[model samples]
Target: MKESEKHISHFDIVVIGGGASGMMAAGTAAARGKRVCIVEKNNELGKKLKITGGGRCNITNATYDIHALLSMYGKAHKFLYTPFSLFGVNDTFRFFEERGLPLVVEAGNRAFPHTHNAHDVFRVLEKYCIDNGVVVMLDAPVERMVMCRTKARIDAIETSKGSITARAYIFATGGASHPETGSTGDAFHWLKDMGHTVTPPSPNIVPLRTAESWVHTLSGVSVDSMKITFLVDGVKKFHKTGKILFTHFGLSGPLILNSAHTIADMLHEGVVTASVDVVPHLAHGDLDKHIQEIFSEHKNKNFKNVAEYIAPHGMAVSLMMMPGMPLSDTKVHSITKEERKHIVHTLKDMRCTITGLMGMDKAVVSDGGVPLGDIDLKTMRSRLVDNLYITGDLLHINRPSGGYSLQLCWTTGWIAGSCAE
Candidate 1:
């Protein structure tokens, strides 16, 4: 049978996954006069994008230097130089702003809509796709790819609904993170079967569950300007100072999530421990002196009464219950010098045993997919499959939360769409 007769559906470009990259790729390709069709497993497009940045949709970071921006991905930094240079963060701002969506930079160079609604970001992409004549197949899961061995290319994609044929294909099905959004690592298996070197996917930007149950009581309380350090086998691997929230499971927020990638690896090796410096800016000796002053001033008051001034609301109550701390009924002046030191140590280095990471269902972005060496960074096209392209979390790039992940989608999707023949 002829190539055209064997395939069920035909298009100039077929994008699997109606996510940030898939939608962007389809829209960009269709805008350039290519017949485009997007196959998405989810009923709605940009489901994960809609909930990002706490529903504000952190659009992109405002880092102008390509090197500085790439540095956020660590080892994956080198592979991103070409893609960022082609469609950097600045280009992303221009791309969205030009389409009538102006972005506002929030704390830490994170960009979001002025209205602070993630749905608006999705709306723009939806409009762009519709305006450019891109066909969207919602609720369609791609089951496998039909490779043309003679041409050494991906000739067609088989989905739960049916098969789709295209001259070129882009896979932006995302990773195993946020399973409710339909990202379940299905694309990884399909690509692995096609002879691509696939990295085992794991939860990256996810919350860490601790062995201590006291952390649950501290849920909803966030520590600002705090420092969190991840130590692997007694060696500190990574540390970052920012804000983190106490969760029912353990720790979360910006700092904890960013450190989750390294923590997950440590947990796999054996056991990982995290130390939180609530008062990172204060020196240990200085904090000790300060506490002495507080003790002297509140000598007549109960130990618990003095806690309110020294710690943030609710923290004092939790701290008093920590190991070796005397009851709240004890007089502040009655506390011993050694006890004071213990209190200071507890405040400075609140230790938590990291048992494991939350599942992909809670991860912001998953780590694992097509290995970096398997794709051409310049065009984001697969080195093994001539007509295939990869983008977004589907690539094995570890990036901190902000707008880095979405910016990646924009950069890779744009390059892949433009380069697709």
Candidate 2:
């Protein structure tokens, strides 16, 4: 049989990329009695969704105030007003709860499956698609879109397997980050060819790589709470405070991942540095007094041994090893006034030179995709292309982690699915 003729099917709606948004869109459309087909390049569905929140898919934020939720999106918050109003976070909670999937809230109002299994979330979404009669075509990567000369609508989709003609098409190919999850920014180029404006993708929630090799020695080390200040050309640019992790490559965890976008941009222009405050809650005077107390209590102990109480064990050792700082073997009581001041400073602000980002593969999510101007906010239908809807990371919206990104998927996917003609 010819490759072109071996796999061809028709549907009322065809959704590309079977991640969070595509699956939701396909399921919703199919539930409305539309013959929906999902085209996914991966062998399985929701490859990315299966790995979110370290494999415990954060479904949505527990923040119920619409205003507060919107503010979390920053500038893109305005564009989400209509979509989220239709299917806000509360609606998201209900959608899953009604489907027999209970969610639990964490420290930051992040809602995850009660079972804490991302695979469970994917299972539910896949089951939703099946229950609604949506046909999924896996390993069917799209090649191009067939467009009409006189109309702003897709006629057919040219794919790696064959061509699929649909009355309505939804592109949810996602952003360029985590290419291993099959999000290679394919739709950005395809949409550009279809005359839609696309924002070039950049690593948004990526980790930072430090120039210091000592950072690698601190691998697997984590601070429950700390503050990091981004400095360009030796001047402060911005700061973030939260859980921080030291990796073999550099700094990561919640704080560094969220700050990578700005840091990446700054690194492109000039030398970027970071000052990590291990104890931001303590004032200089208070920290000095605290250190004095610790020294007095451990006067006979090595300085390194006493420093452990002030910072992570790895951090304490690193501080003592810093140039001109006190020796690790020095007794806590023997440390001079100058050394005491240095110890205080190190506890407050340990510095590092940030060389670059940890690469897109290590990024939690990427920012920028198809700009919002190309799609109608109310319906999610493309203004430039009729019979076409865009949803999820495929659209250029910079969102932070902690359920904001997945919420975008649920809101836009529902809108695109419900409003598609």
Candidate 3:
């Protein structure tokens, strides 16, 4: 028998795209004694999962209150009540813990494996599918979805390997974020062809590319705590306080990534700029006194030499390079009170202009897929196609980082797997 006939021709359920939701759906269906198969394009499953949260795998947001948890999903929060009801945050905790993968909640109520390794998260999901006897088909990319001749039902999927037929189908192929991980939004096109409205995808949870060359110099520096204020054409719009990592390309870390979409909207208004307050906790008077003391202590030294004593580590040089700021080479003893005040202001309001959001290639999550109205949220089934279910990023839901995306996957996948016939 060829690769096409390697497994049984028919399965109780066929799940496409073996990432977080696909694996969860397949395992859940198999646990119900249904024959399930997950067709993955990549040779290994969980390609995206292994790299989430910078390889730590933020498993889920541990916000157990259903209403509060759903609110993180933005406008789609209302549509998620049914699916989340089936498998809420507490159920996620119980499911993984029952499977021997104890999760620990960190700051921001984000949950992770005890080992803090994404591979460990993948291991648990992979084992869940294996223990439930779900068939795993690797390197089998589905080319298209075939429909039954007389009805609006998915009959079978034509894959690179062969044809796969199932009574019920689940499309968890994900959105166009991190294409290298194999989630290239292939299912969106198929869903559109099948008569489902697919919202065009855009990178929502991604980093901001900046117009400043100085930001590039401070590449790997991460400020543990700082206040960043967003300004549109010099008018202050909003501000956030958190950790931020400066990248060669731009700004990242949880704070910047979560703020990218909002900044993207601000870009449409006018010139977007951000002011980074290096010492947010300290008042200007206190900071000036502290800096004056530092200057007094190093009176004989050049300002550049003692710059690190003032600003956050690795940020002093870049902060000094800000336009209209004092010269770094000036002797501390000779520096005027006004120049010192300028240094304090520059440190407190370090500026960088926002260019735009990073492309889908660097996106943590992309929004845009089948709208919630097209699906029966309670069953995770397509209202248009009776036997087809949707899960994960394939649904257009805008959510910030900090494990909310993975939580959506787990909730929808479990519900679809359990309810699909």
Candidate 4:
């Protein structure tokens, strides 16, 4: 087929989804002498990326060991090793730093620009694309992909604005998380229709809503270094130790979001229960002894007055309301051993009912997309379609926060763009 006859709005590459990966792929391809165009549904590019890491944009983790980095991901760890080996953390660090965006590694090795602005990350990519002659079609949503069966290639992509044709196509539309940011699982449906296996998308790094009403009162209270354990069918299946934030609805933060996946799985099968060890560092016996000592020392004082030192600030009042303790009438000297045990148990195991997940609107990342087995990891090119490639959260790769997701985007985007020819 003639080059002019085969295309409508012709380019060397047409990248669908103007997200992190899409921008990266377009810029990289354009840099490599490939004419590139990006079709973005939103009026602005990198809307989601702009707000990532609470607007700081956790660029990448500082870890260089491929094995240790792979271990961060659950089952998807093995699939990512090949890609990481090609363009791992070191490449990600250099990619930004070389572009005048120096990165700083924080407490958990989470890398962010020295300015800590997500806009800077976007600026670097935007500047790179413009400098390399990449065309960006803003407010253009890809309606459908037209594939030529005889050639087994994507001939053209129909967008809301118009049609564009290219020799190669890259999908980096992200996942269903933060639909307000324009990610609504459109890529998954598009890929599924094109004969690729797409996993059912679910809320991954999202908050969990609890059934308890009192939890709402504790909104904005963050517990650091707490161990959260998820129970399925009365069996403790998942557990993680980190920081968690109590919201008006329930719980969130790094630990809670990661545990939500396990909780969702258990909830699908049956009922699930969640327990938080607020003072995980303290042994039960040690905690009990500590409480006993506090009570003995404050024997002459009122029970309510002594409770403040043992529990978290503002939590003592809530604990005093539970079963035995009478905040108004009981004195520390009159408090029985049984009541003290209850307080100790409450302090150790603060239980909450797992009502439901917060949904994609609040998710940090969504879990579901084109199955990994359906795409070639080396090139990020589709196994079914000859010229079609997938990248970012659109590919089913389970990962946690702290810059792993963005790194995946960078690696896969670079690979897809490099292989576009």
Taking all chains together, each candidate's TM-score versus the true structure is 0.93, 0.95, 0.96, 0.94
Which of the numbered candidates is closest to the native, going by highest lDDT? 3
Q: What would the TM-score be for candidate 3 when compared with the true structure?
A: 0.96
- Candidate 3 wrongly placed segments (more than 4 Å): 1-8
Instruction: Please give, for residues 1-421, the per-residue lDDT of candidate 4 as tens digits.
Output: 5544534578999888888999999999999999999999999999999999999999988888899999988888878888898888999989999999999999789999999999999999999889999999998888888889687788888877667888889998899998999998888887888889898788888999987765667788776788888887677887888888888999888878777777777788777777777778888899999989997888888877887888776566556655555564578778778877877888777777888999888999888888788888999989998999999999888877889899999999999988887
How well is each residue in 6-76 modelled by candidate 1, as lDDT tens digits? 45678999988888998888898999999999999888899888898889999999988887888898899
TM-score, model 4 to reference: 0.94
**247-352 in candidate 3: lDDT tens per residue?**
9998988899989878888999999999999899888999999999998999989878888999898987897787766577788999889888888888888889
Worst 10 residues of 3 by lDDT: 1-10
lDDT of 3: 0.91
Worst 10 residues of 4 by lDDT: 1-10
Local error of candidate 1 at 359, Å?
1.3
After aligning candidate 4 to the native by TM-score, how far in Å is the CA of 323 from where it should be? 3.4
How high is the CA lDDT of each candidate model?
0.86, 0.87, 0.91, 0.86
User: Which window of ten consecutive residues has the lowest lDDT sum in model 1?
Assistant: 1-10
